[model samples]
Target: MNQNQSFRQLWISQSIANLGDSFYILAIVTFIYNRTGSAAFAGLFPILRVCAQAISGLAAPLLMDRLRLGTLLWMAEMGQTICFGSMCILYFFLPSQWLIPAVLFLVFAISMLHGWAIPVRNALVPRLVPSHLLVKANSLLATSDQIVLLVGWSLGGILVAEWGVIRVLEITAIMMFFSTLALLFVKDPSANVSAQPESQKRWDRMKEGWITIWGNPILRTLSYMEIISGLGESIWAGSIILVFVKEVLHKGEDWWGFINASNFAGTILGGLLIWKLSKKIENRMLFTMLISSFSIGVLTIAFTYSSNPWFALGVALIMGPPYQARSIAQRTLLQFHTPEVLLPKVFAAFGTILFVTFGFSVLLMGWMADQWGIRFVYMSTAGLYVLSAFLTLMMMKKASRSIQTQKEERYMNKIE
Candidate 1:
């Protein structure tokens, strides 16, 4: 297959995998809570997933360097297929009391593999398309991802409630297996391998991504913002959102599906808008960061106070564009700035930060939900976004100054 056609195939495969991920997450969280009747218990699953992701992210760059990108993609998909397929079988045969532990173990395993899969997928995109088309490509892929998410989030709850979680998981496994087949037609891209000390310490090698981020001012600021934003974004933990729907909004499983689907519908719209306006978006990074933080703050506050489910859905729809724009911009910026040799490590570090911060935030928010109410937790997340907005504005100024200085330095070097 040609490069463009291969990318399209990869995108479709990943979209299917994304749908499976969404389905399994909603199904598993609801399953846990339905059985245990504890939001805290359900919360543990997200923590488990993120914690495994964080650990795996630390090693993702190493794996990416050692293995073919296509191999990583196929391996991750096949691994998850096995994990989910095993869960489906075991759930039926295992003792009732063993279900939770068994599910948790598989979730952790799937998540660990996922940690490797996502960064590899992201890093592979730039290789698939030329620099000029990167923005459009990212936008289209993001939209596809969101569309699948929209379907998965919307249908997952209803399916779980109607057909049962085990059945949903079985279907998810089948989808994952199908996704793995697509990679067989695509050729793996060569890595931009960099030289390293022959005797470099393992710890130093492990810290390569972190060290790179620390050395780059823009990456440093963006990485910090990601961590803080993650804290605010913790409200998206499945159990917490489910609790909000059930306890605060007094809704059912369908409502949970509706709310999440509404959020993802907004994401798809936002991706389309960004794709159309790619040339018009001057200073993409600053605009995305500022708008993202501001919109998130506004939506969080609006959703927090809204008593009606429809009103909450309306707010969710409005939040979509800024969220999509910010993600697209951040990704574009990373690809534009970081060299290919270092990009995997940089992305690995960024993912690790997000996973670690997001994981703990979910656990902490889960406890707070029990103590202070889900509404309070939602409002608190809004406060975090506000802080993120303020910080991002400050960083924008810093980035502009850095860009100007670098331009002058390059001009002087040319003259010399």
Candidate 2:
């Protein structure tokens, strides 16, 4: 099959897997919460998963080259299936005290697989589609990602409420099993490709991606910007936002819900906007940086000045489009800038850096909010956004000058 057809099939399979993942997580969390009766225990799930994912992301660069992309994708899906099925068995057979640790362990395992799966999937996109289509493809895929998240979160809750957590587990496993089957049809174009010389040490293989990013001026700058953006974007953490609404706005829990919903709605709108304007958006990097910075400034202002919940909702709504647009633009830029052979490693390194920064930022911001105030944390994140923009702006100027200098040298050489 043609690459386009293959990508379409993979996309469908991924969507299914994404949905299944969402359901499985919710089901597991719900089960924990119901059993333990503690939001803290429920919250630990994400933290554990993120920790596992970060470690796995750090390891992905070394693994990606050794394994077939299609094989890894399918294996991830199948692994998840086994994990979920195991969870079901545990729920039925295991004693109550053993459940939490078992659940947490499975969550870590699933997250580890997911960490590698994401970079592999992203690296495959450029291979499947041409350079010209990258923006649109990324936009559509991101949109679908958000939509699947929305559907899964919404439907999973309802399903768990209607049927039991065990039933949800069973359903999630079935979905993952189907996803594995779908992946079987994806032919790995690079399967026949030989690996680098055996003399390449394990440490060297791991460092390859890091070196590639450091060696490329554009990628290096982009990495810096993303690192800052992660810190800034950590304000989106659900718990922090909820606290902000409750303590600062003196609003009810429902207001927190409203703001959260608005934020996600904005994300969905932003993804759609990017998909629609993908072709028309010239200078993707510059436009992304500018829009992102401006939007964060706007969000900061809204949070600082507005005590009205409705105005806060409006601000949340406005925040989604630029955030989604910037994400797509940045992703496209990475794919365009990085060589195809090194793309997997680049993505792995990027994901690792971003995840680690964001995870810590969330903790840091949460503490700052507790000690200082939520408003301070919000403003600080906005400042980081501005700083990142300024830094990227300088990098863009430097790149332009370098390009011009090369062009001038070429012209002079022709005259000689």
Candidate 3:
């Protein structure tokens, strides 16, 4: 297929897959928490999700060899469909106590397989787009994702609350099935093809991917930034609603929905802005540094000292743009420089580190919130965000300046 067909397929696939993903995530969190009235059990989700998904991610490089990326996509969908069927049967008809964990395990296992699908998709994009358009491709993906997430969270909450969790899970599973089917239309560019035989062992495949990430200073720095960003973000995503409902507003527990919806709205706006910015910007790494710094600033303001619900909601609304901006930039940078042969391994490693850090931070913040109240926990998180922004920003600024100087030198050499 031609370049245009390939790019079109990628964007369409991204939209469908991300929309299904958003639905599943919202359904799982809302369903598990609703069934058992325990925020701690709710918080157990990050632990369950990250651990299972991390294991899948670490093994993804090896699995990618045995299964085609397209085949893996279908497997993830079928697994999710069956999982939701079990959940529907249990939530609607069976009122047994043991059923909750069983459903939860099924849902989480599906997520683990889906996690394995991520790197394979990430590895596919650069082959479709030119080097200069890598940032644009990533931005498009993020924009579509944000739009889906905004609608997903808002509607998922309503679907669970109004229709019932089982119904929502069933619908989400159907969407996933369609999304998996959508991948059949993607025009695979031969640029992404790997050697016939992958490495010998699971560890061997894992090592090969890691070696690429380790060998490149840029990739190494980018991975570290993603991990730190994940940790900081966990404090906000994992605990912010608990803080708002239980501490800031002193309202009924249900207000978590409004707060989550508000923050999600902000993310949608951010994604739209980044989508436009991607066309105008050429330097993905430097763009990431700017957006990341802005994200920290917004986060500090939102979580550090908040009293009123409306004001808190406004702050939450502003948080999305910078967060998404950085995400789009980071993904593009990875796809742009990393060779296609090693892309899956590199992306899988990125997923492992990112989610693991996110899970750890959630565990820590959840504990602190339970003990000292979420206010203090959030206040500390705000400080950490500011510090990270400062350090990473300075480093990226220097890198950006150096790149400009090198370009000028190369131009001068051509003239001579």
lDDT of each: 0.83, 0.83, 0.71
lDDT of 1 by residue, 1-416 (tens): 37787788789889989999999999999889998999989978877887899999897766665567778778988999999999988877999999889989999999999888888778778888777778888899899988887788768878988999889999999999889998776665665444465577667777888888898777887787788767877787667889999987899978886787788889999999988887766356676778788888888999998889999889888888888887888788777778777777788888999888887787799899999899899989888878878877887888788889999999999999
TM-scores, one per candidate: 0.86, 0.95, 0.84
lDDT of 3: 0.71
Model 2 RMSD vs true structure: 1.7
lDDT of 3 by residue, 1-416 (tens): 47657667656765766766666677777767777888878776667777888888887877676665656666766676677667777666765687777876875787688788778778777766787777767777776777777777667667767887667677876776676666666666554345545436657776777788889877887777777687678755735566657767776656666677776777778777766776676655565666566566656566557777777777777776777776777787777768777888889899888888888787787787788877776667666666656656766777779889999999999999
Q: What digit string (tens of lDDT, one per residue) describes model 2 on residues 1-416?
A: 47888788788888999999889888888888999999998989888888888888788766677677777778877888899899989988899899889988999999998888898888888888877778888887888888898889878989999999999999999999988888887766655222577678888888788999999988998898789878988887887888888887888878877887787888889888877777786355576766677677667767766788888889888888878877888888899888877888889889888889988998999999989988998888788877777876787688789999999999999999
10 residues in a row with least lDDT, candidate 3 = 190-199
lDDT of 2 at 59: 83
lDDT, model 3, position 65: 68
Residue ranges of candidate 2 with Cα displaced over 4 Å: 191-195
Leading candidate by TM-score:
2
Higher-scoring candidate on TM-score, 2 or 3: 2
- In angstroms, how far off is 331's CA in candidate 3? 1.3
How displaced is residue 3 in candidate 2, in Å? 1.2
lDDT at residue 256 of model 3 (Cα atoms): 68
